[model samples]
Target: MRSFDSTGVMEQNISKWELDTPALCVDLDALESNLATLQQTVIRNGIASRPHAKTHKTPAIARMQLESGSVGICTAKVGEAVAMYEHGIEQILMTTINATPFKIERAMNLRRWCPGFVQATDTPGNARALSEAAQAAGLVADVVVDIDTGGHRTGITAGQPALALAQLVDQLPGLRLRGMLCYDGGAQHVRGFETRRARTLETLAPATETFDLLQRSGLNTEIFSGGGTGTYNIDHETRGLTDIQVGSYVFMDAQYLAIGGATDDDVYSDFETSLTVLTTVLNAQYEGRVTTDAGAKACTINQPWPIVKGETGMTYSSGSDEFGTLRYDDPSRTYQLGDKLEVIVSHCDPVVNLYDQMYAVRGDRVEAVWKIAARGMST
Candidate 1:
């Protein structure tokens, strides 16, 4: 193992153990397994995967996904799409609605660099704005109509409203309606398999009906996209979905496992838990508790405290900005100061966004480090 010098520079090539604590680490083997499983699953179902890149936000992983037979990638924001495009990912679907003038202009500018860039809209006003902006830029922007398939986050209600918006987009001068985007984000974590499946179907009904109405009206819907990690398999059961936009499958988390779609081996439906936060115990003065160097700032506190990897009796709790308290029932087991512990984050998305880079490791060896290129693209 290489040691950090007085200036905090390593003398030799760094291994996983030699790297600083509280680091974001990706198990390369598990990551490869997850990527392959998703590719195989989508291919076996005769559907295409446009994996949401908002989870990892790393272009290296996105390129790997594309190489693994993914049709495209989906991003949560226009800025994220631009970042990905700058990394050489051309086929990107900006899932979030870019309505504001600045964002719309940014999307159009992004399309200039990557012509296959597409944006989503849930309202006719936004569609018109996109059209006008794209026209002013002398570029036709490909657009998708986002249907409120139960998340109620940022989409318009599916049905006549959806059909009307599609009609409006078709009439718009510089926007081409690519298809519909229906995502039941809440249905992705329904706990039981049957309940999750039924909930997904029930919630997707409105979007399916809207698609039917649009098709009957002679509207060309080239792609019908939407699906998350929890419902990726179930999404294929539906005839209306042409592309599944699963993201978290690339890196399973405690929140995802709580949704209950894992296989018999406890894997998250064949997707392995590749991403983990490596923390070192800094304080062991307490009798029943120990402290690590990761907390709400490092790992997400939005869900539950991260699971202490491989320690069933140990429970983690939030400490201050840069610490985590761990409690254990087994008094026999003692946590020594400087001991390393890997924690499975409760939520993978925001946790990944917290770090600048992730160390890709194969066992104890650090293979490479990939930058989280779209870390703070909140636009």
Candidate 2:
């Protein structure tokens, strides 16, 4: 009954079973295997691997990925980058655009914290702002031009417009154009292997053209970084991409599983589902319905329903902000009060952001408690 404790008062070295319910758990063995596989795959393809820290948001895991041969780590925000720096991660790429005065200043300071710090830009105004801020801070901020690549997110058109932005950054005094970044987020989840591969290739065409344009304009950048777990294999085979900035491959979720692999025959099982939510059945008085403690606040609501580990004939439904309802097809299999259940999260990113710490478990024992360093670091 004492699950979901964030008081920071729990004793150290507690067994996994002894912990309270509704806890965030990471399988240490599975995590290590995922890290090793990603690094090995990237190395086999001869491309730099920079795992995105925004997914795990734990410095311990970031360090493991780096130690496993990742070129660097990618952060989604300046605050996340700061957290990584506090944990002694020296090389970081802030993969989002920062334009506001305070955010630009914070990003500039982060550059000072990590010598290899880099940020992305898609507009000339933002580029100028970054250049001015870096100049005022007495630093030359490394920058990457962000290509839209059909995501319709915060990026410029990949070909001429992206090259134009790179040119502007080059002309700016305190901004150094490191390379171009084209992350096809939608292509990463295109379901079938051939469709995902074809979509990823088509989306990156403009990025390739932009890279070539930059070279012809006498402004060849050093790196072409952008990729996700969904398009890791596709990006690895793409010639112009220098580094694959993948995040979710480390602790895959239901969404990634549904994306399937290049063969179109199986889920992208290159990595294991190392992360999970351990919930406790709080109520089971109903005939075929049970309720657990994990809700939107715990496991995130953006993804599909969480999968009940090793169980069939049951479906998890959203109940309240702090609870989930389980509907079972097998009425005979009734759950009792205080019964614990393990669920693979629907989405790993926001689910990780909801917890302050995660228990690294091996079998039934807790191996370590890793702090979520960048939980609320949205800025």
Candidate 3:
């Protein structure tokens, strides 16, 4: 392996070190376990796992998933796809719709570089825009029609409109109709397994019907893509889905754990919590309370309050923008200042996006620092 010297040049000399607290950390063992577990699950169910790279946003993790037998990766933006392509990721599915000329040009550029680029479009106009751009670039772009599977986010109605989009792809020059892309973002954290399964079936029905309609209309619906960490297993069992695009399973969060879908035994035996926010107890004030360095700025607080790992009888509370208050009902139990603590973020994706790098840790040592390459690439 190559090493860097004190002058910051690759000299094969110096040892690397870790920074301070309030940094996002990945448990190497847990992360590898998470990747292997998801890959095995998808393979066992006979589905292609194309994990969404929007979770980690790092090419290194994407490579891990790809090496673990993931068919490809999904991104929410063209810039992310370009980054992944530059990093030698050939196959990519841009999950969002790109309608404007500027974004279409970017998509075409990516297709030029990586011929395996695929995108999802919901409207005929968007499809036309992409087709025109790709035709000008002299490259064929693979396209999937996005269907609104109860998320109400960015997909078209999953019936005639979906079929129309597929037809548009078939007729449009420089565009190939690959399949359908429908995501039920609402099912990611549904409380109970039965409830999630029921909602998933309800959400997937229209999309599946649309695929069937397209097939019947002589359009080959080759790919039916959707699913997330919370509902991968359920989506895998769905009849028409040909591929799974789960992201957060690589980095389990507090919200995913709080979700009551799978039984406790099922969760424990299945996915491992691979991500955590390492914080230090900044202050020990108020007999039963302590404050940590990580708060809203370090971790995402949108879903619910975070949980302190293995700190029984202690509940986490938001102190301020930069402090997290920990409370214990037992007056006898106390946490002192400068105590290192691991916090499970309520939401993993947004929390990971907040940091610039993730420290991959093994036991007590920091092994690697992976840059969050796609962080803040919203445009």
TM-score (all chains, Cα) for each model = 0.94, 0.95, 0.92
User: On residues 4-119, what C-alpha lDDT tens digit does candidate 3 reach at each position?
Assistant: 64542221211222346787888889999988888778878988899999989999999999998898999999988988888888889999988788988988888888878999
Backbone clashes for every candidate come to 0, 2, 0
lDDT (0-100) at residue 217 of candidate 3? 98
Query: Candidate 1: deviation at residue 242, Å?
Result: 0.8
Order of the predicted models by TM-score, top scorer first: 2, 1, 3
Worst 10 residues of 1 by lDDT: 5-14
lDDT of 1 by residue, 15-94 (tens): 77777878899998999998888888888998899999999999999999999899999999988998999999999998
For candidate 1, the lDDT comes to 0.86
Q: Residue 360 deviation, candidate 1, in Å?
A: 0.3
lDDT of each: 0.86, 0.86, 0.82
lDDT of 2 by residue, 290-341 (tens): 9999888887776678988778888886547989889988643567998888
lDDT of residue 159 for candidate 1? 95
Instruction: List CA RMSD, all candidates.
Output: 3.2, 2.7, 3.9
Regions more than 4 Å wrong, model 2 = 1-9, 264-266, 331-333
The parts of candidate 1 lying over 4 Å away from their true place are 1-13, 262-269, 331-333
